[model samples]
Target: MRLELEKRPERSKIMAVVSPIAAVVATLLTGAVIFAAIGIPPLKGLWVFFLEPFSSLWSIEELVVKATPLILIGIGLSIAYRANVWNIGAEGQLTAGALAGSLVPIFANSWQSPLTLVAMLALGVLGGMLWGLIPALLKIKSGANEILVSLMLVYVAQLLLDWLVRGPWRDPHGYNFPKSVSFDGWQTMPTIGDGRLNWGILFALVAAVALAVLLRRTMKGFEIRVLGEAPRAGRFAGFSSDRMVVFAFLVSGGLAGLAGVIELTSTVGQLQPNISPGYGFTAIIVAFLGRLDPIGVIVAALMLAVSYLGGEAAQVALGLSDKAARVFQGVLLFWVLACDTLILYRLRFVPGLPAGETAR
Candidate 1:
């Protein structure tokens, strides 16, 4: 006997909605087992890893801050994926954006005005779009695989940022450190109150609402869905796949870039060797977890943000490794994909049938 997967004739609408919830439950159970294996009480470990993040006002604020970047990046990614354009180089685009946005503060340190902040934000989005455009053009012009090209560019962007920070952009007054001059005055994002929460959260909320409108109430959204679901039909409808590809990449890259600049200005306050905590990569999971819906991504982003806070809290409270958060994220993604697969396909056993052969 052998097991095989058979695609369902029609996907169940109910299962589609339940898939993410099932994945979350499965992840929690698996996390419990992992905690037990590590010699920590499962209940205690789970509390620290999940529930503890919302126990205080400060932690809640940090959660919002963490979720902001995820929401922004996830919204853009949802649009790209909807159009069947896989732009995986968001991390690179984010780095490029941060680098471009930092130019104003690093070189023109004396320039302080509201317009200065506006320029930096604009530059951030432009930088990301430019970085993303490379793969789009290559794919359209030369038929190159976007996945490979975009992923490879991430390392290039990282190396470029590393060189700049370690060499030209290093802070002169500071003792040897891989960082640029600190941003001040209008260079940094303004906070709502005395807490760490900043205006970046508002940007994330606005992006989600805007994209929700774009995807549901516009012709462009119809094109994206049509192209993704049935490219032949989209062609028949006179939608240009090439333009869609460019649009997807530019939109996703720009959001990622915006997130990067906001993170630098609001949280870090300067350019550093490592500015992101893998927000771009994490946002991919966020996009999928939200079922590629912009509004859903907001909630999903907050869920993932808990893991980041939990990771830090676990280290201090439970003596867990800093990498614990990544492990949880990986398990969550695995379960999510698994559940989604089951939603669209059923498992069958074929007795006395050879592998790769269907029962007649």
Candidate 2:
């Protein structure tokens, strides 16, 4: 018998919550098999991949450091995706934010003040908004596909970053390298403890909480949800679809930009081409894994952060390349899509025609 998917009258709410957990469980099972095939003890390898990272204080701090940007970016993406804006260029927005935020530090290298920090944050948001608006305008005015436009912009941002670091932004006094001069005390982010943890973690948490409130209680939030779920209904209710698209993209881009600046000032302490290790893209997974809720995004971000820490642990212990995060994310994304599909549809077996049967 063959199987076919039949549409469900309504989506399963239980499935919506359970799918992310199921995806993680499935990824662990798959990882175990892959580890065993690679000659590593399945339990030991899995242990290293998942649990070992949490066993140390330093590791926990590192997780927060890694998760900060993910949470920030994911929260923004949650807003955009919920509104059906389809903004796939957060990576580009992030890069643009970093580029704009770094301008003050790069050119005014000697200026040392707290205001520099404030300026960076503002410029970062503005840069991201401008970059994000391009596709929004194109889509609204010319019926262009935002998905393609945003994706292509990623390449542009990356190339622009590469050019700046290797040329103008490069430190003049230091040895030849494609990197900027390290930030001074005023330029660098303040630390919470002895470790590399910064205030950005706190910022992430606050933003998530604020966004959660905005989405759950605000009239704009209601508008966004209505427009996303049923545009026809939203219009009948007097909401403008075009306006929501712009609003969603701007908020998304602004948050992503803020994340970029935070990563620069708080973590990296300088502008570099490799500032983000696909945090923008990985955040897409985080957003879905969180079910597009801000608080949920925080949880999802921490889980993904564990993958980064675990990858490092696996590399150190098993001498394996640290691709744990990427692999886990890919599997998780696939499973999320699968679960979402199944939530809206049920599988039914279809009988095949008997071999003896002949067409008339």
Candidate 3:
């Protein structure tokens, strides 16, 4: 007997809603097993890894802070993926945005006004769009795979950031560290109340709502969905694939760049060799888990943020490594993809032909 997958006549609507939930449950079970294997009590470890993050107000605030970047980037990615454009270099775009945005504060240290912040945010989005445009142009002109081109650019951006912070952008007064000067006054993001929570969360929420409207209530959204589902049909309907590709990349890259700037101005307060904890990469999983919906991304981003807090909690409470967050994220993505597969295909055992006999 041989096993084969048979495609469904139509996608399963029930499974569409259930897959993410099922993935979460499977990941939890797997986490329990992993904890036990590592000689920790399963239940205790689970609590430390999941529930402990919500046990305090401060931790809850941190969750919002972490989720801010994920939501912004994930919303952008959802647009790109929905349009059938694969952009794997959001991380690079984010780095480029950060560098571009920082030029304002780095060079205009004497300028401390609201205009500085405005310029920084605008340049950040522009930088991301410019970086994203490269892969789109290459795909259009040379038929290059966007996946490979975009992913490779990530390393280039990282290296560039490292060089700048370590060489030119390095703070001269701060003893010799690989970081730019601290942002001050209007160069930094405004905060809410007395907490570390900043206006970035508002940006994330606004982006999510705006994109949700765009995807549900706009003709452009129809074009993206049509092109993604059937390229030939889209072409017949007068849709331009090249334009959609550029639009998708620009939207996603711009958001990622905005995210990078928000992280810098709100959280990091300066340019550095590393401004993100894999938020660009993690947003890919967020986009998938949310079923490529902007509104759904908000909830998905929060769940992933919990994993970040959980990892830190586990490190202090259960004596686990901080790498636990990555493991959790990996397992969650694996299960999510597996569950999504079952929504589109069914597995069956088929009887094999006897001795390779030719039958007509």
Candidate 4:
């Protein structure tokens, strides 16, 4: 006998919506097992990691602070994904943006001004867009694979930042440290309170709303969606593939660059060797976990931010290695992908007494 089931198209869409939630639950359950294996009380460990971060106003503020960059990058990635463009170089673009934005402050050697702030922000956007354009141009002109080119550029961007901070952009009075000079209050983003939270949260929220509207309520968005789902259909409707690629990459890279600027201005208050901590890469997970929807990305970004706070707490309270937290993050991504696959495919079983005599 063989076991088989008919495929359901509508069921797949419904599962896609629930896959992320299932992944979260699976991660928690799997984590509990790990905690027990590590000689910690599973319940207490889970509570400390997941609940402790929200038990105070301060921690809540920190969550917002960390989530801001993720949201910005996730939103940008959602747009690119919707247009069927893959921009894996957001990390590099982000670094380039921060590097370009910091140029004014590093060279000026004076108090911050409105002009400086605007110029830096604009330059940051330009830096990211230019970096994004490299892959787009290659893909269009030479049939190059953007996924490979974009990802390869990330290392280049990191190296560029390392060289600048360790060389020309290094602070003069910081005793040979590899970091940039600090920004003045005017150059830095204004804080919401005495906490780490800043105006970057508002920027992320606004961008999310704007993208949601643009994608759901505009003809341009329709073109993007069509192009993503069916390139032939889009071409028939007069949409240019090259234009979509450039537009998607520019928007995604520009937003990632803006996120880099915000992180520098609001959180770190200056350029550093590792300002991002992989926020650009994390945003890719955020975009997928949120189902590539604008509103979904916001929620997923917040959830991922909580995971970061949870990691810190686990490190401090549980005496766990910092790398332990990364394991949880990796598990989340793995299970999430697995859930998505299950949603699209199913398992089947067969039983037989013999290969030559297969009759029931």
Candidate 2 residues 177-246, lDDT tens each?
7898888666767899889889889989999999999999999889989998998999999999888878
Model 4 misses residue 245 by how many Å? 1.2
Span of ten consecutive residues with least summed lDDT in model 4: 2-11
Against the true structure, candidate 3 has what lDDT? 0.93
lDDT of 4 by residue, 1-360 (tens): 665444556448778878999999999999899999999999998998888989999999999999998998999999999899999889988988888788778887585677777787788888888888999999999989999999999999999999989998888987899888888866788888888888889989999999999999999899989999999999999999999999999989998888888888888888778988788988998898888888999999988898889989998999987677678878888888888875766646667554456664
lDDT (Cα, tens digit) per residue for candidate 1, span 1-360: 877899989997887889999999999999999999989999999999999999999999999999999999999999999899998889999999999999899888999999999999999999999999999999999999999999999999999999998998999886978889999999999998899999999999999999999999999999999999999999999999999999999999999999999999999899999999899999999999998999999999999999999999999999999899999999998998898987788888978777655554
Give the TM-score of each candidate: 0.95, 0.94, 0.95, 0.92
Give the TM-score (vs. native) of candidate 3: 0.95
* Residue 309 shift from truth in candidate 2, angstroms: 1.2
Q: Which model is ahead, 3 or 4, in terms of TM-score?
A: 3
Tens digit per residue, CA lDDT, model 3, 1-360 = 776788999998988999999999999999999999999999999999999989998999999999999999999999999989999899999998999999999898989889999999999999899999999999998999999999999999999999999999899987898989999899999998788889999999999999999998999988989999999999999999999999999999999999999999999999888899999999999999999999989999999999999999999998899998999999999999999987898878878854345364
Pairs that clash in candidate 4? none
Model 2, residue 63: what's the lDDT? Answer: 92
Candidate 1 weakest ten by summed lDDT: 351-360
Winning candidate number (lDDT): 1
Candidate 3 deviant stretches above 4 angstroms: 1-6, 346-360
Candidate 2 wrongly placed segments (more than 4 Å): 4-9, 347-360
Name the lDDT value of residue 205 in candidate 1: 99
Would you list the rank order by TM-score, best first? Answer: 1, 3, 2, 4
lDDT, candidates in the order shown? 0.94, 0.88, 0.93, 0.87
